[model samples]
Target: MRNSVLLLAMGMLLATGQPGLADDAELIKNTKADHEENGRWYTSDDIPTYKIAEDGTVDWPTFSGFRRYNAECFQCHGPDGAGGSYAPALATSVMNIDYYKFYETVVNGKQEVNAAQNLVMPALGENKNVMCYLDDIYSYLRARGTGDLGRGRPAKKEKKSEAFTENENACMGE
Candidate 1:
């Protein structure tokens, strides 16, 4: 219920590209990167997000997110999350949906059937390719959703952290 409401509100805001109210920006604004753990940067809210440097260089995670997203998600979500006939535009969707809800939807999947229409998102919690890089994907979409990052590959990116590589290898069973 709450997720639906949040989605609807955010949808309207994204559609208009202007806040209907003064505080609407608050609802859509992505938080700043406050700290890092094991090579991943997170917001003060403790959720994964993106960070772009002054020189248009993106964080390693965001860059990785782009790679991972293109590797699979673009098939349904469309390149750069622009939304396809099969799936909605995730770039905007991520901004409106809270991080936890996004995780839940991606992991558990979502189903809504009605007289109006039918929508289904398959459960991907077990897809190691996606699950292992979930945070990176989220960060990439967050950057896209907030317009902090542009479409296509990033011109520059930070180097991958050792911690990230280890965790990724472990997750991938490599």
Candidate 2:
């Protein structure tokens, strides 16, 4: 009956080694950079994503993201968003949770406490460093989550755009 069909479908998916194939397709589509402004790339849905050159050059914002994440987030999320004893892998689920939720969570923070565990992420809404480069952080995590960018520092990166430099200065109150 229906359960048998469902089981068959699940088995087929596993056998083919394409777990969540449909989800993968959607992820690919949603993460494709449709445009760029000030050296940052965004998908058609307005979510951040990394852009890489054929010669292995990463976009500036993505590089900025790596720096920002390491500076602001790695303490809990572990190096390269790989997760740690203290936090889940942001790189693993950022894409799955989607951009809006990620933005909301980072800005407002989240807390869960119980006998088994207590988890909390402090709000970064007022942190100029994080808030200013939120998109870049998302772009970097998305790239890592999607396997588009590997761990460690990117060797080649495009020069930061003047607009990005100006915006960063303004946001940071420099």
Candidate 3:
């Protein structure tokens, strides 16, 4: 009976374009009372929402930046972001496209340069953070490997050491 009354009152409120002062008060009271009992009216301050920029770039760094290079470019570019046998290494590529040109292609997706290669890149967008990340990736690639960003660890090499001994002919009695 109480539920029916509440529903009827809400329905009447909806039907009436202009709710009176008492109606509004009743609505608020009912909502608060119900919410207090059900705990369904709580508000959350944080929500994850992706906002794409006008240029199609993501507002935040996509894949935190590195992942973008890895997922979209690493296949042909190699782990270092340097072009492999299948593609031109980023560091030494003749394209020499600076951040702006590179950004254009990234935001616009594939371009018609070297159509014979049949490569079709997709746009990433003009999101400042994302673009900044791209710059970081570029910096990483510029440092050495085609992969943008600084090399995390130096390449390893085998070490050799020797000592002279009285019993050994190679060392003699040094």
Candidate 4:
């Protein structure tokens, strides 16, 4: 009876097309899902890293992430996600927070207050500068958190994928 109820619940969740359920399943199964680009998904653990070339042209997304992070996030989060007097270091925070939580926090914002201090993160879900390149921001931050990328602008990067360009254009309505 319990098994049947669990199965029924799973079926209902699938029918509703909820997002986190799949991530939960992936976690339980110890499998990483493919990262999506242009609504299509592909598996790659190294896709987010900056690539170096002899001439030093950087990848678009990671470079864009640096630009966006400095423009929007650095004021509060500090340079290179190192945290500040006002905000906790995202390089450390992202280590424990799941991607869904990170996404939701950015979209919805968060606030915590106590005798020691008040911490507030403003909502940016509707901001085009953030909403359009959330994936890139995540990629860059993840790289920073994992020590895959270092401080300062990368010297070089791989070429942007066609899917990345398509998604960027679509997201920006260009």
Off by over 4 Å in 2: 1-29
TM-score of each: 0.80, 0.82, 0.37, 0.67
**Model 3 lDDT tens row, 32-136:** 111111111111211111222334333222223344466566776676555676656665531244445556766787645673766655566754434434543
Which wins on lDDT, candidate 3 or candidate 4? 4
Candidate 4 pairs with clashing backbones? 51-157
| lDDT of every predicted structure (CA atoms) | 0.87, 0.88, 0.42, 0.70
Q: Residues 1-174, candidate 4, lDDT per residue (tens digit)?
A: 999999999999788866676665454222122555543222354233333234755456767777788888999999998898899888777666766788899999998978977888999999988988776776667667766678887767665678887877888889
The C-alpha stretches of model 1 lying farther than 4 A from their native spots are 1-28, 114-118
> How well is each residue in 102-168 modelled by candidate 1, as lDDT tens digits?
8999999988878977878889999999999999999999998878899999999999999999999
* Tens digits of lDDT, candidate 2, 26-142: 854477888987667888866678898888799999999999999999999999989989899999878678687889999999998899999999999999989999999998998
Question: Candidate 1 — what's its lDDT?
Answer: 0.87
Q: Which window of 10 residues has the lowest lDDT sum in candidate 2?
A: 19-28
Query: Cα deviation in Å at residue 45, candidate 4?
Result: 9.2
Residue 54, model 2, lDDT? 80
Clashing pairs in 2: none
How many pairs of residues collide in model 3?
18
**TM-score of the candidate numbered 2?**
0.82
- TM-score for candidate 1: 0.80
Where does candidate 4 have its weakest 10-residue lDDT segment?
40-49
